[model samples]
Target chain A: MFSMTIIAILMVVVMFVGLYLKSSPVLQEKSFWQLLSSSEWKPMKGEFGFLPFVAGTLWVTLISILIALPVSLLTAVYITEYAKPYIKRLVFPILDILAALPSVIFGVWGVLVIVPWISQHVAPHFMDFSTGYTVFAAGIVLGVMVIPLLVSLFIEVFSSVSTDLRECSLSLGATRWQTVRKVIFRQTFSGIIAATVLAVSRAMGETIAVLMVCGCVIGIPTGILDPCYPIPALIANNYGEMLSMPMYEAALMFAALILFVVVLFFNLLSRIILYRLEKRLG
Target chain B: MRISKSKKISEEIAKVCMCLAMLIVFGFVFSVLWTIFSKGMKAMSWDMVSKLPGGGFYIGKEGGFLNAIVGSLYIVGASTLIGLLISIPVVFFLNVYLKKGSKVAYLARLAFDVLFGVPSIVYGAFGFTIMIFFGLRTSLLGGIIVITLLIIPIFIRTMDEATRNFPRDILDASFALGATRLETLKVVLRQIAPGIATATLLSVGRAIGDAASVMFTAGYTDSIPTSLSQPAATLPLAVFFQLQSPIPEVVDRAYAAALVLTVIVLALSITGRFITNRFSKNKV
Candidate 1:
């Protein structure tokens, strides 16, 4: 059993080493830094600069976080401090089930409902693009996909802010809103931070839903309305044709490695903070 | 008087703002579900489940997704079985053999956490990488391996949470009986059997619903996979592929597939609720 755990742990190392070796062929052809910086990706011309995908990934993730954070925070606050018992009973389960809804379902919903609506109603008023498949659309979909995660984690965090602290704040002439804003939020700062970090990590790697709406255009998005290709979407869309094109597999592998590292770093950051606090308490 | 009134006003304002935000969140959830249900259920007929796609199925003719239904069941079932075999032992070692907060145990958990955050599409990419090196093509085996890898962290975490709740006195009681460490584990596992069941169902929900990890590896076929080496279809992939078809009938069928997928997942969640409730009573 102990050896099995070691093997399971070694699986992570295996993934890292395997990704490096697989991607090294491409890295040798083009320096890793160049791949990170260059934006062009024409498989037919054999020019495989993956900067656009990386940038798209970052842009969508950033946008989604910006859109999701405030709503999720406030929702968490309401659920924790204000929701009626019946509402809590209803809302939490919906969020939990929503979290588990297949991403492809979200993709289907996005393609059928959001795309047409955005393209028809919202796009005509805005800019050059009238298609619903924009970076902003993808970001909004991703934000929706991640809301359950943020709300659930934040609720746990807020609930753990000791009742004594809440009482003390309210007794000192603080309103319910002020008590939450000043006392609970401050006390649960680490938890909120961890939830946000984890949510960001989750959003960065979102593929199916993003793929359905992001238009899969392999260029850096100048504006949110412009279409873009995220790293995960790039890999999913291009992997099927990998055999027909040389260096395609390596290129996709490199993109996957970057996503792996970025998400890993954030997860580690959140884990370290929470783990340290856990140790301190004991 | 003025200050108190202002403070009360702000409280009222904050309450209204939060209430609106909650409403917005619920709006998204409700809309997503409503869209799927309304659009999806329209084309969801008995034939969609009972029959297999025929020659004109892609061209908007009458047929079913039995192939994908069986294939998804096969892939998710086999991979989950494998995942459980591996995850059970590893989680047991973490909680039983190691000291609390031991560096090795912490490293194991950390490794799982990192792996958990690696997106499923990346897992597909990684799985495809190894498959190519080994001179393997897209096959059910590939999807199984990748998916099992993808869900292992989830299984480990779920089971680990359950094992953590195992009472120390249970171990002591076993020790007092001259029971060995292995014996203690058996007893400990039984106490947390409900957690094991919940974890199994939850991971099942995850494994069945995911499309990306299996996208490249599980080379799609219109027929059910007969062996590990054979290509298999999955419901999520069916929904994706069918939705992309230009034909309206095929597109509606995609919604039907989505309905099937959603129903299965929601059912698993309900089962999870029942299992947790059933087990919560037994908690020490």
Candidate 2:
């Protein structure tokens, strides 16, 4: 039993070591900073710059969090604090279905609906002759994808606020809204931050839906409407054909390593915050 | 009186905003489902499931995604079995053998949490690395290995949660009866059978829908794989590759494929809930 537990814990270390070993070829050729900061991504020319992809990832994650946070928070609040009992039952199935839907299916939906809508309606308002496959399109689709997750997490966080405090606030001449804002929000503030951090991490690593809509181009997107490629898309789109160049395989592995590390960091941070929150609340 | 009136108005505004947000969320869900169902129904055909891709399949000619269907079943089935085998033991170890709140258990849980958060793409890349080291090409075996790794954390975590909720008195009761640890494990397993079922269903749902991890490792094929060494196609990959075609028929077929995947996932979720509710009544 102890050995089994050790094996489970060792999985994380094994992943990091294996990825680093595979990525060492590229890391040996260029410093980590150079690889990240440079914008050149000519694989054939052996220049692998990750700046554009990283920037694109950040842009999509930011846009998604921006769109998802408020909607999910408000919706969760409505369901938990305002709605009738039957409403919770109604809302939960929707969240479950959305959560169960595959990313590729979401990609197909984005391609058929969101892309065209953006190309005709939203993108033209911002830029000239957009193909609708831009960071913004990916962001919007990704935003929708993350909404169920955020809403679920937010619901959990909101519910964790004790009813006694809510009663205390209400009995002190506060309205329902006032109690929610002051007592509930105050109690769950760190929990909300942790949920957003976790969602941001999720949005960062999402591939297929974002890859389909994000244009998969190599340039840095200066605006949301511009076509851009993210790191996960870059790795996914290139790795199959990367055999001809040894460094290319290593470079893609390095990209994977980057995602693994960053996601691991965020997960760790959120876990720490959540653990502290749990301890405090207990 | 003026202050009270202002507060009332503010409350009304907040409620209105919350309702609007809910409306937007529901709107998106319905639109997505409607699009997939409408497009999928248009392209649904008998050939789509019964036969493999024939000549000129990608050009909207005579071919279906039987290859992907069988391949997905093959991969997901094998991986789930392997995942269950490994996950059951680890979860038992966590909840049964170790003291509650032990540092090792906490670290293991934390590790699984991080692993769960890691994207499928990274797993693909790591799997690819392993394949290269082993001099293995893309094949069904590669896909199974990678997917098993991908889902172990999910299985362990879900079951761990269930195992943690297990009543301590049950273990004490078995111990007082002079039952061995292995014998007592049976009781606990019986207690968490619903949890195991839920975990398996959720992991299978995730593993089947995944495209990126299997993209490089599984290696799509035109026909269903007859051996572990052979490349296999998956429905998600089918949707991905078919949607990229310029032909409208092919693109419609992508929606058809998406619809198929959605139905399978929704079915799994429904049955999972049903099974949990059914079995949970027997739990202590």
Candidate 3:
């Protein structure tokens, strides 16, 4: 039995080992700081700077979380505080189905629906909007994807708030708005923060859906309307041809390593916050 | 009167804000499903699942995605089975064999959390590098290995939560009877059987829908693989490659493929719910 647990833990080590071995050459050949600081990412030209992709990743994640946060918070509060019992039952299944819907379908939807709609109606108003595939479009798609996760996590937090607290506030003549803002939100602040961290980590490493609509360009996008590649998209778009150039595969492997570390860091941070929050709540 | 009116106004504002947010999400979900079904219905046919792709399939020539459907089944089925085989024992060890709050147990739990959050694309990258180092190519075996790794965290955590819900008095009862830890495990396993089922199903839903991790590891093919050495095509990959084509027919087929994937995932999730409910009666 102990052996089984040990073997399962060893699985993570195997993945890290594979990443380390694959990315080692790139780390040695190109200085880590140069790779992190430079913007040039032409694989065929042997330039493997990843700074732009990092910027693109942070840009999209920031935009997505910004768009998603208010909506998720509101939806969660509405469900917990305002929704009737039968309404909650009706809403749960939709959320579950939405959560299970594949990202590729989201990609398809983004390409067919969001892309054209943005290009025709929304993009032309901007000064330099080039195509349908913009960081903003990808961010919106990611916002849709991340909303369910945040809402669900927030629902857990909201549901776990003690009824006694709500009653105390209400008996003191607090309005629904006042009770939620003053009591429920304050009680679940740490959990809400943790959910935000986890959701951003999710948007950061998202690949296929983001890849489909990110336009696959390698550059520091000047604006949300410009096409650009996030780190995962850079990897997904180029891994097929990475073998075509010397160290190209290793460079992409290093990109993957960077993605791994960034996501891992956020996940760990979220877990720590969640642990502390649980301790407090308990 | 002014303060009371102001509070009422604020409450109404909050209500409107939440309603708008819910409406936006509802619209998003509605449009995505409507598009897939409308397009998928047009392109879907009986032969799409019953036959393999033929010549010039890329150009909307004759053929079907039978290969991908079968290959997805094989890979997801095998990997889910293996993930269960490993996951059940690990969960049992954690809950029954180890002391509560032990470092090993904490580390194991934390490891699975990070693993669950690790992106599928990284798994693809890791799997590709492993293949290179081993002097191997993308094959069905590679897909199974990577996918098994991909879902291990999910498998472990679901079962861990389920096993955590196991009653301590039951364990104490068994041990008081002079039962060995191994025997106590059998009793506990029976207690969480439904969770084991739910975990396996949830992981299956996830494994079948994921494409990024399998993109590099499971080399695409037009036919069902005859052995572990052969590469397999998956539904998500099929949808991806087909959707990129300029042809309308191929693009429609991609929607049809997406519909297929969505249906499979929905069915699995519903099944998971039923099993979870079934076990809720036994929950301690």
Candidate 4:
């Protein structure tokens, strides 16, 4: 009972603080809105707008999801319906290991290897690509970072489809491909969509790796080859320095609030999907 | 019988595709490991392991990672202990004390789910604001508190599973022997000590590897913390900070640190699996 009370008190306190920060007068000032809407984000010149950061975040996240979803889904399908048991075991462990790898490691790898390789070999190939730290490079790295998660979710959903359905299709003289397309894929479509949304959600919130590779430019990205700055990257790059600037701190809080809403939406969507799957299966 | 040739062809194609997919996944794993090994190996000398990063070209020559290593152990250990200590009681209360459909237990489960999904960075931001309010800024204690928050949900879920799976007949038999509820729990349920220990260890693994939550709340300090209130660095943060440098040596050390961190997580995960497997077999 005592511990329960403590937890309740802590929760209330946390919730109150979060709400208070969200509604703070400084955060409500018209100047804050003006600053956020302004195109100029030169903190040195005392101008800061969040438009470019928002654009950068959307650009990287969209590209990442686009690249990751198909590859991860194909990998999931291969594992669930085609791979032998021995191969499944090997692939699953590798996926789990990849999932467990720290974001910092990915960041270091991105900077040390990926960024340099792109700068030297890949960037010049694209028109208007003056720098290697483009949205495309960061998107590819982010895609790789999120692939394991999408693959696992897809596998779980695909595997949940009953074997009897597959057998029924097969017994009808359908090919294995036909069985997958006509039976398993149709049954697991909602799950696949849920997994894809969740993957995109994860891509949006990803920080350290994206921050390292995205060039942290404040300008809007005109193309995939242009430098970008994501919201998480902005928070990470500016949070330490923002301690001395109250307005910047407010901006960081604002960015965090936006991020929180995005994450919460994804979490809600995932939970709803999980609940539906459970109810359908039960 | 007439469709056998088409079936065989499709199966063959499927097998080939499966092989290709597995090879691609394995290729990614091999590449990551190879990159770490090739870059990290150069910084893996005994002195590097024994010393911290220092002056120019002093990749790992100032002081040993003894501090971060010990801090990591201490923070994770303390958090795991606190999390298990808090969760086991909650689990027992729900399973043994509370009536079915109790609001508190239901709320507890929901809260745990929310906690599980809350991103680590949000936790960091929340912890930073709250800890600073409580005058616990940049302290090892703050780090422990943040880690405790991160692991509590995991332990509660795991222990809930463990306790729920404990045979009801054993509890009944203990009660029939004139033992009270608390006595029955202490005597009968204590037998699952290994499973509980394994859950705690798994929580430890998570706490140890968590970098984002600890980054802001437990601001990095190079020196060893003299008190729970002092700032300190862990291996994860060390890698983060080192990777920011432009120096080749520091960068190399970062990869070496990554390699070390990965090994630790892998060890803990393997041990947890072993324990869970043993327990399942024993149950059977």
Chain A TM-score of each candidate structure, as shown: 0.95, 0.97, 0.95, 0.89
Residues B218-273 of candidate 4 have per-residue lDDT tens digits of: 77766678899888788888787777777766766777787787778767766666
Give all TM-scores, in the order shown. 0.96, 0.97, 0.96, 0.87
Q: Rank the candidates by lDDT, best first.
A: 2, 3, 1, 4
Scored by TM-score, the top model is: 2
Tell me how many clashing residue pairs each candidate has.
0, 0, 0, 5
Off by over 4 Å in 2: B1-3
**Least accurate 10 contiguous residues by lDDT in model 4 chain A:** A8-17
**Candidate 2's residue-wise lDDT over B213-269, tens digit each?**
999899999988989999999999999999999998888778888989999999988
Clashing pairs in 2: none
Per-residue CA lDDT of model 3 for B121-230, tens digit only, reads 99899988888778778899999989998998999998898888688899999999999988998888888989989888889988998889899899899989999989
TM-score of model 1 vs. true structure: 0.96
**Candidate 1 stretches greater than 4 Å from native:** A279-282, B1-3
RMSD of each: 1.8, 1.5, 1.8, 3.6
Error of 4 at B117 (Å): 2.6
Candidate with top lDDT is 2
**What tens digits encode model 4's per-residue C-alpha lDDT throughout A152-250?**
888878878888888988888887776877788888778888778777777887777788789887799998888999988887666578767666676
